[model samples]
Target: MAVTRSLSTLIFDLGNVVITWDPRPALPEQYTGQDAEDLLTRLDFFTRNADHDAGKPFAEWVADLRSSGDAEGADALQHYVDHFDRSLVGLVRGTSQLIDDLKAAGVTLYALTNWSAETFHHAQAAAPALAQFDDILVSGEEGIAKPNPEIYTRALERWDLDVRTTGFLDDSEANIAGAESVGLTTHLFTNAVDARAWARDMTGAAGV
Candidate 1:
């Protein structure tokens, strides 16, 4: 499928889109089975974790949880800090190749990720594919996060890119909608195979 959209910029979301990240590996071993599921449910990782991405003081948050008598929760958060690198399992299959293809196609690439600045250091060193991007906008550093219109505007302003010709790829429905609200051509990412095909069609960057 070809879009004939004349895309000049391709914006990518990092976690689960370009790289595989899961906090389960960093969680304590004892929290398993139903208990583990309960812990996850109780913690509300995505919602609570957003605080971290929004530049909240990590130590203060943990201390507050501990002071509230949720020592186990505090320990879990600490475990995340300690084993942060482990959370990034590896690159998402085939995205590195797709990024190379986009670069080879002369499309300017940039990253808009709702990741904590503290944890993103591992990617700068371990994920070579990220190096292909012209620049990366991290929520933690920006003190804002996705599904927020401001961050999208900030990305566009920072890169001096036109929203009409830019394409965005992300796994979250809310984030995709947020990009659409800001006038970015959006793709809801599922896997690299489909993403590559969509990108090729969208950007007219069809060659290997």
Candidate 2:
């Protein structure tokens, strides 16, 4: 059965949902070929990258990597810093249009994302479409990330939104579970196409 409700508030997750961010594309020229692959495998970029989302300072992270005798990892992290904007390829196709449609339908849009405080500005500059959101909550700024219930509560309470009527979209299952735990109508995102469809259905913005 489709659980129907008047979902007035629509919340979006930034990474992958709105913009493309694949760190592998940012590999430095010096680290190309086998060296790049080996360094990525050794550093576990995605796993350790979460530390940045958790408010870890870039300088501190690089220091730790260097101290741990992973100079290659440190260099890779520097490369990411140098190519921060490039790392985020561009906007997720169709999402900008979806935002416009949702707005036309009188649905309020907000963003709850686990993006690093230091790097978020670059994303904003790279993808001006993000500016369409009425409000945006950054986990790094709040010292908390998704999958942690506190951040969800903060976003909900900040807008004085009733969890039952608020719809939250995220690509991570764990983050979806976290939103559900807080009583939000959660959508587990697979791609922008499906995500836009679900938003339209929930907000009745299909024709708008």
Candidate 3:
């Protein structure tokens, strides 16, 4: 395919978009050389909750879950730290060639993700290319999350993007629908390869 249609901007989700985000690899390391098999079996640390990520602090999240009967075997006071220590390793992923490719095309790029301020800050080192974007919008700071219409609106608002000329890529169905609800094009990202193909397909831009 050749570059045919032009777009005002391209927005991307962070987790599985430009980064390799699989916590399974790092889970065992969490319990390695320990009595526990892995943290997954002992703790329900699968996904990030939007509410806690919005304005509530991480300490509040730890307290809420701790009160839910998920007792910490070690020092209860240190549970949050331990959890973050082992779990945060899941955030790192190398530079996405697809993003680089898009930037090379002189396309306006932006990061619209539901991430806490601290976590997103740490991500700065993990994914430096993220800074290359024209803009980055995180839900924690925005005080909203997808599929909430507000967050998407906030993104569009930041860029002064025309819904008709913008496209979004995310891993969640709800988020994609939310984007489409607001008049922007959406792609359900299955993997980096799939995302790259769909991006090209959507904008009628040829693959790199």
RMSD of each: 1.8, 1.6, 4.3
lDDT for each candidate structure = 0.88, 0.85, 0.68
Which residue runs of candidate 3 sit more than 4 Å off their true CA positions? 1-6, 22-48, 65-95, 204-207
The TM-score of candidate 3 is 0.77
lDDT of 2 by residue, 35-150 (tens): 87787788877777777887888888789889999897788788887788878988888777887778878889999999889888987887777788988999878888898999
How many Å off is the CA of 71 in candidate 2?
Answer: 2.2
Give lDDT tens digits, candidate 1, residues 30-109: 87678767877877777788898887767877898899899998898788788888778889999999999899988899
Candidates, ranked, TM-score: 1, 2, 3
Worst lDDT window (10 residues) for model 2? 199-208
Better of 2 and 3 by lDDT: 2
Candidate 1 wrongly placed segments (more than 4 Å): 1-3
Angstrom error of the Cα, residue 47, model 1: value is 1.4
lDDT of 3 by residue, 1-208 (tens): 6643356578998876665453343433344444344454455443444564575566665666578765552233244434443334443232367887878866778989877665566566667678779888888887777889888888888788888778888888989999989988877877767777766766655544
- Lowest summed lDDT over 10 consecutive residues: which window, candidate 1? 1-10
The prediction achieving the highest TM-score against the true structure is: 1
Estimated TM-score for each candidate: 0.94, 0.93, 0.77
